[model samples]
Target: MEEYGYLWQLALILMSTKFLGLLTKRYKMPQVVGALLAGLLLGPAVLGNLLSGVVIGGHHLENLALHQTDFIEHLSEIGVIVLMFCAGLETDINELKKCGKASFIIAVLGVIAPLIGGGAFTYWFLEEGWIEASPDSSLFIQAVFVGVVLTATSVSITVETLQEMGKLKTASGNAILGAAIIDDILGIIVLTIVTSLGGGKATAGDSAPLWLVLLKIALFFVFVAIFGYIVYKFFKWWRQRDGKGMHRHAIMAFVICLLMSFAAEYFFGVADITGAFFAGVIISMTQEDQFIASKFDVIGYMFLSPIFFASIGLKVDGDAVMSMGWTVAVFAVLLTVIAVVTKIIGCGLGAKVCGYKNYQCIRIGVGMISRGEVALIVANKGIEAGLMSSAVVAPVIIVVIVTTIVTPIVLKPVFMSGNKTASDVPTTSKLVENYEQREKIGKTNR
Candidate 1:
């Protein structure tokens, strides 16, 4: 029999996540924190390594071998996509429209600040003998690539954190989500530009001309518009004919989510989460959205979500940290600090310019701090293109782990410290009135 390793791994993950999730909840921290800690504890960084060495009578210990596997990775991917889809279902389109301009500004500044900050820091660090570059590699290009890495914002953690606090519908929450989506787009464009500058190498999608890359992105929107309309009409028709709460509707929702996700990465070079999010937004306009969300929520919560959160912690290679020596360890620590502070300052300045209150600005900045896997992906691309060394991967991993852990811890308190204003977020009834007012204004302008 093929060893049933995955079964035990899944069991350990779910049990530990549940126990630690409740443990963190009792301390008024987001339960996601506990789930993260659980992964760290069970992963190679901590317990996995400790237990791997022990043996009872001749059989080697195999229980805590929660090293991340392909199976768990795929499940976690579904969990995050599902999480973002649920977020889209809850989003108010009208409200999102009101913040659209602000979102773009925040994203632009957010990306620029980190790009500059990381690049400047890396350049200085190189000058100070912190980084050892590969032969004949341009330090300036390497610095730029590091900055590109910093420009990424992984909002899955932020989404979970905001949902737990019931702030997902708030102004700051919407801004964070909106900016993050735009940030991903901007980061991709910047990554493509930086990668293309490397010596005749195709890094990520840099093999294509910039204009072609952009055109594909534009076509992706067209794809969404056509497919989104079809989805909207089909869901509405089905709901009218069969009423609601059907299991098939929930199943169809998953199909649509996966289809969009595949098309995004495979065809358009966009993040799969972006496609999943738009799928949810399109569905949200249909009558079955809430029911679908409820059904999907249970699936995500019970299985995929825990695996997703835990898988992040499982990426930590404690041996890499220890082997890289104190000098590299110090670099990782400083880089982590730079990663956190740059995002806050850059995004916060954008919020302030958009006329948000200071508290809201702070919350928005904190919300965007989590780099997650986005940074790692970018760094990997840089390495493949020969613009970056393999050595940087360790520090980048540390940055991802730190930022992922810190975003939620800092975000919850920032949100709790401030009360939302009506101007910032319209009430449900006011949403209808504002929608009508905007309609009238559109007619007048036309």
Candidate 2:
């Protein structure tokens, strides 16, 4: 009976996500929005509790305990790993190299400004005794948590928007993509620092050694670099062999994904997604990357990604939001604005200083404003680590959702206008010669 109950819960989750995802697509919004709504509708604040006591043919729904929620959550975490892996796989190394200086400057400012702003805001509120936590709770910990939230800039939406606007190959698009990749790395480091400070067990003075933390991160990448090279060589040799079909290539890529994900968690103390990303990156070095990426994309978009977004909404405490009332609303708005504005000012100023045109700077800044799964994952980790409260997590979730939704809508027009102007300009012989020269240099390095 218990086993059957677990199956029923899983069925409900799948059905709800599929139904909501289809509905959202019909309205032209991201499928993620619909999936999240499904969770909200099915969760305790809505129909969940009312349906809690009801049973089908005397099979009590109460038998399906909340423990099943853990299954959904774990599945969602896997979804994140695969999603990040896909992102890394799609990244073009040459494109990133073109935006090198601008991307670095923007990424640095984007990280630093938010860290200071978020930390300052937390210190002011905590010092004023505004929160309900123990007075002894470390302000530094809370500030670090805020900084962590501010550090992420999810590029999925931005990339899609640029592609839709036909500006994906443009300078602004390249800068945005490069800056976003940097933002993800910075976010991970911030999370590592904050998690280390909190000591993982909520107790004081159990913090990991700084050297150990640095070693863990460094070693993870070193393993990836070395292992990645070996795998590429093996794949090249395999391609030279008689078995060069799709089946052989797919199996090899899948194995690499699993192995890298395992090593990341078990050996490096970094997030499994980080390892998965490196796995994808390594696989991407192969000649068959385009084919493999297409296969993974179909599976990821059709199923795993939607389930992950829905799970976030399901895990949220609707009752807590209502109970907190105005505080949650105010915090969500304030945090969302800060998250968006700081990224723009930081990345925008950096782009301008790096000699990009005004519109190019704006586009890059807007591109860095979107936050998605990465923010949610970090927030969830903070909750589990006891460094962040439910109150804090809820607002951060709201900020991520809002930024993701707005970035595409906001960036499209700016990108489109830029494209129109560039298109109207005639390609003179001198311009064509310069373009060919640059392409030659780019190809030579590759």
Candidate 3:
């Protein structure tokens, strides 16, 4: 009976997510937006309370007083991990290498500008007695919190929008994708540094060893490279062998991903998403990347991804945003403007400095402005870490939601208007071919 109840909960979540996802796709909106809306509609915010009495009939849904709401949240976390992993898989390493200089410059500026602007703004608004928060909290801490929020660039949403606009293969689109990938890498590093700082002491009144943290991060990469190479070689070898099953290889890949995720969280103090991301990158280098990616996609899109996005909507308190009234409204507007402008200035300057056309630079900046899952994950982590209070979290969430929703609408015209020819776009296929050729040559030499 207990097992059956659990199955029913899963069924309800899947049905709601699928229905909403298809509906959103028909309207040409991102499926994430649809999933989030579905969660809100069925969650405590709207339908949950209304159905609570009748559904439970004055008794808790589960023996442990488990509510449908709690179950959804748990499932959402799983959704997030799978989503991040899939996102990492989609990242084009070849494209990144081709546009390395422009992308790196743009990513650096984009990250720094936001960090400075967000930090400064938060210090001005929330540090003093202006907010009713505790006086003992230092301005620097608040500033760091704000800086952390600004560090993430949600490339997934931007990429999808570019693809939808049929501009994903264009110069500006490639530049944007390149810049966004670098932005994600840098953002994770910043997140680690900030989180380490916030953690304060490792022991009583003693700070965590900075060297140790740095060493751990370095070691993580080393393991990723070596292990990834071994995995790639093994897969390539296995694929050449007769009678090898695809399912066996797929399962092995998943096991590796999960192991890496656990190691990252338990041993390195990095986020699980970060670990999963590196795992994806490593697997991407293997011969089985496409097959493994396809297998993962089914589970991710059908179950995990939906739950993750929906959970975001479920967690949001509409009343909180409303009650804050003018403050929330004003801050949301200001933050949104700042977020967009900073990315433009930062990434544009970087691209321009790297010899890109002025228009191309601007397009790159616009593309980097869309914040999606990564930003939300960071924000949620901040709240969990107690680094961000309600006031800070509310405005940041509003900024993320608004920027994500608006970036596609805003960038479509600019991308369409660009005069750059297809030849101007970097070709990732050539890069990948070159890489593989080099690898083969090296093997021959050995």
Candidate 4:
């Protein structure tokens, strides 16, 4: 029964997502937020308690168990891959090159600010005075892990907001996207170094030295730099041969993404999501990037993405959150506030350093504020290792949820409420003209 229960889970996920998604869209929210709520609605946090055995369509949700469904969890994992893949696909390499110095500066500062600010706040939660049972070193690792978690920017929510605001192509938006991607890569590197040094109980820190870890990281990048180039050249050749049809290109796109994803985890000990993201970046450097992005969008946004967003809500342990006590709760709220502030300041400062107008810097910072899958995944790794307590998990999840929910809701208004718009984003006529020129250029290249 469990083996076949994913069918019911799929039905409910899609139904709840579209229904709730429509509601969010109506309220001018990204569909991603609604999809998350849909997951919550049908997950153990909500539905499991309310309608555990209630039968509908001759299927008992009792048999589906979306919150802990192993099958659905795997599907949701793929959803992350798809999300990262699409991010890579849509990333404008030319824009990144044009904005290279600024983007790199922003990404570095964005990461540092979170690590410093979030780490300090997280240290408050880690103090032996607060939780004496955990070791001091263990607590330090957890604190570092928390800061590492905060460094992650899911960007999918921000992507939706920017797309809606017609800011996806704006200078600030490109900076945000580039910085977000850079931070993911940097965050992964930080996690690798920290975890290898025994930040989590599941890892053997004493067994591996710092030099060896750094060496492996260096080797990983050398491998990426080399192989990534080969893959890039091959895809460019494939693009030239793609006039016959795009079906094969689509298959190759997914395959390449999966291959890179597997290599990231299997070989480099990095998150496969990072590999998947690079795979998309590889594609984005091509003539067919937009086409590939749209193709994946249909399959990803329509199908896989809903499962991923919904799965997040399914993990909500309301009981755990409740039992965390007021102290932990206060800390959680503090952590969330810090997460917002650090992102705005850190990333904003980075943009300012690049000579962006003060408002544009603010926009970049606000855009980078959200934390999603990466944060949760980091926390889960810590909890699995016993380095992080279950008591802490609740607060961490709460923080992720609050930040994710708030990023989209506040992004546009922050941008729109500011003045000097006509000179900022492209006017409608210019936008149309630019689109036509790109289309013509795209055709000429083809």
Candidate 5:
């Protein structure tokens, strides 16, 4: 059956994304671009619309292509979680620590710039009659929420690009990763404050106090520390006892990732991806990290990641977006420009202030530009709160797609043009050298 139609839809998504991914790879761009394009082409935006209104054997063919949108969306969520988990596994903790201060500065500026830029634009757009707000909703809260949406940085795309380029271990790459994690935390704080002030517009009930929000975030980290240590020891012991490489260890790692992900959202109101990432970080402290990462990568790359990337493209509401007319189109274009430029200027200034090379600064800025599920989540909150018009989502979707697409395109060149200097190269190389030396010392002792 019809009940099993998702099978064929899955097939289409994988094949299309992979083929397009290969096409993009030829142009020296990240395969993520191809995957995104494939989604847009196959979803209601392009090909899906073409199939509209056709009936065969009393069954609509349109439903066949989009078989189980909810199911596919869930799979995509798992995809990003797994991707971030893998990033955590591969991350160099020492390098991440070294970049801590710089990452904080970068994240702070990254959030502030977008918050101001997006909020200003929304207020101006409202003044110009480009968008509308409910009479009950405060224009100030609406503007701030839009800015909060812009502050999100979906670094999954950047992680893939860095991994493809073999720069995931580079100092600049470490800075990007560290800054993104901080960015997520800071973003949540800002969202909590704004949504609280929005007076339950963003949620079903009264929002928690700012102090409670801070407490929850702090507790999440404390939970990570205590639980991470326990899991680290358990895995270490598991590896020592199972001298014959058992596959179950990887399964256990997956369980921990899922648990952390659940806890993050359920208990802390933090992003699940944050939980999955730290789970990987905890496991990375174990001897089986490489093995588990390899296993998870197979699950992520072969199945989940393509769907995740494509699901983003699948979100484009072609008719709604296209019907918005010239004014909304202009707003979309200008908003996209604002989204791109504010991130670069903001994060770039932060990096520059922290003594990063100009090219490295640009790289960090570009890496933080993409906004994904997070932005959509914020926009949905605004809609629920009556702070934003449902029609505004079309423009937000365009911003997400454009920013996501451009990050890799622009990052590739910035990364390529930079000659490695002492500032950019030292921490990365030193970390590698130290890791190797430690390994050699362990072998000698054994």
Candidate 6:
């Protein structure tokens, strides 16, 4: 009876997620926005307490509606790994190379600016008279984690927006994609360091020494190289066997993903999602990359990922956030604004340094501003690691929601304006054709 409770939970989440997904799509927003809201609604924040009396299981013995969070968190964690793995598989390694040194430069500055912005804010909150000091967590480490959260970029939302504007292949667009991939790798490195070095003052002694941590990091990469080579060969062998559609082939890939994830956390002190991501990257050069990506994409987004997004919103505590007071609220607002503005300045500045025009710089900045799954994943890690306070969770959620919603609202008109951007200026002939094309496309479709 208890085992069957999970089935009921799954059924409710999937149905609610789909219904909200359609609603959001109808309103010209990403389906995820609604899925997250649905989760929040279903969880303690909204509908959880309201529906506590509802008996969901067939035997009516378990209270599925009232509190299914611990179990849901496990599902969401799987979703995170699957999501990152898909991201790795979908990555265009050649595009990353084509961006060349620009990707490195952009990623560096992109990471730096946010680290400064978010870190400075946290430092002020702790050091200055703004927020009361708690002995439980180290202010310094928590500040660093704040900066770490800002390092993430959710390029999927930007990809869709750029595609709609017919600019996905343009210079700025490609730069965004390439830089984002590099940014993820860079972010994982930063995360691994911060997570390993210790979480808070209360737990600093629990961290490995610098040398040991470095050695583990080095050993992890070595493991990745060797394991990646072996997996690469396995992919080749599987190809020769014509196992493209074979369930066993896909199952093996997943097994490899799970093993990589386990090894990263248990053996290397690296985040499990980072392992899953790199594993996907290792196999991405394979002929089966597309096949693996598509299958995992379906399984992840269609089944696992919505749960992750929803769980983020569901776990948010308005009371905990409010308890942090007006200063923290101001910080959240500032964090959101900084999250939006700095990426544009940092990445756009990098683009400008790369000889892109002002409009292209702006586009690049806009493209990098949206923080999606990765940021949420980092926030979850920080909270779990006890590096971030409960107060920061609300801010992190707000960062995800605000940055996601803000990017499209700001991007649509920037690309449509009279000013000619470097990558998107239409010639007179093309303008005439586009005008005619606009007549055929519906407003909702646009």
Q: Tell me the whole-model lDDT of each prediction, alpha carbons only.
A: 0.75, 0.70, 0.68, 0.72, 0.76, 0.75
TM-scores of the candidates in the order shown = 0.71, 0.80, 0.80, 0.78, 0.74, 0.85
Q: Which residue pairs show backbone clashes in model 4?
A: none
Tens digits of lDDT, candidate 1, 356-436? 999999999999999855575566456545677655666777687678778888887888887657744533334334333
Residues 325-428 of candidate 4 have per-residue lDDT tens digits of 57766877888898899989999998888888888888899999888766766665555445566556556666776887798888888777666654367433
What ranking of all candidate models by TM-score puts the best one first? 6, 2, 3, 4, 5, 1
- Show where candidate 3 strays beyond 4 Å: 1-9, 46-70, 129-146, 155-167, 200-207, 240-243, 317-325, 389-394, 416-446
Tens digits of lDDT, candidate 5, 1-446: 85776788898999999999899778645566677778778887777788889999998777655532777867877787787787577665665575568888999999999999999998887777665455546677777778888998888678678767877667688778788867765776676556545653434355677788778878988999999989988877876877775588888999999999889777886656668878888988888776677677677767887887777667666666566568778888898999999999999999999988888899889888988656755665555456676557667877887887788888888888888775444344454454445435433432
Quote the positional error of residue 125 for candidate 6 in Å: 2.0
> Clashing pairs in model 2?
none
Residues 1-446, candidate 2: write the lDDT tens digits. 65466467667767877888788667545566676677666765456555667899988764443322667777777777777777667555554455477778899898887777776776665566543332324767776687777878877677666655656656676677677766766666667556644554454555568788778777877888899889999998888884548767977797888888888777776666667877887887788877777777766776677777666666666566677677667767877888888888888999999988787888888888887767776666666566666556567767876887788788877665553456233333322233234335433432
Score residue 329 of candidate 6 by CA lDDT: 77
- Residue 369, model 1: lDDT of 93
- Which has the higher TM-score value, candidate number 2 or candidate number 3? 2
Q: Ranking under lDDT, best-scoring first?
A: 5, 6, 1, 4, 2, 3
Worst 10 residues of 6 by lDDT: 426-435
Question: How badly does each model clash, as a count of residue pairs?
Answer: 0, 0, 1, 0, 1, 1
Candidate that beats the other on lDDT, 2 or 3, i.e. the better one: 2
- Kindly provide the TM-score of model 6 when superposed on the true structure, using C-alpha atoms: 0.85
Model 4 — which ten-residue stretch has the worst lDDT?
427-436
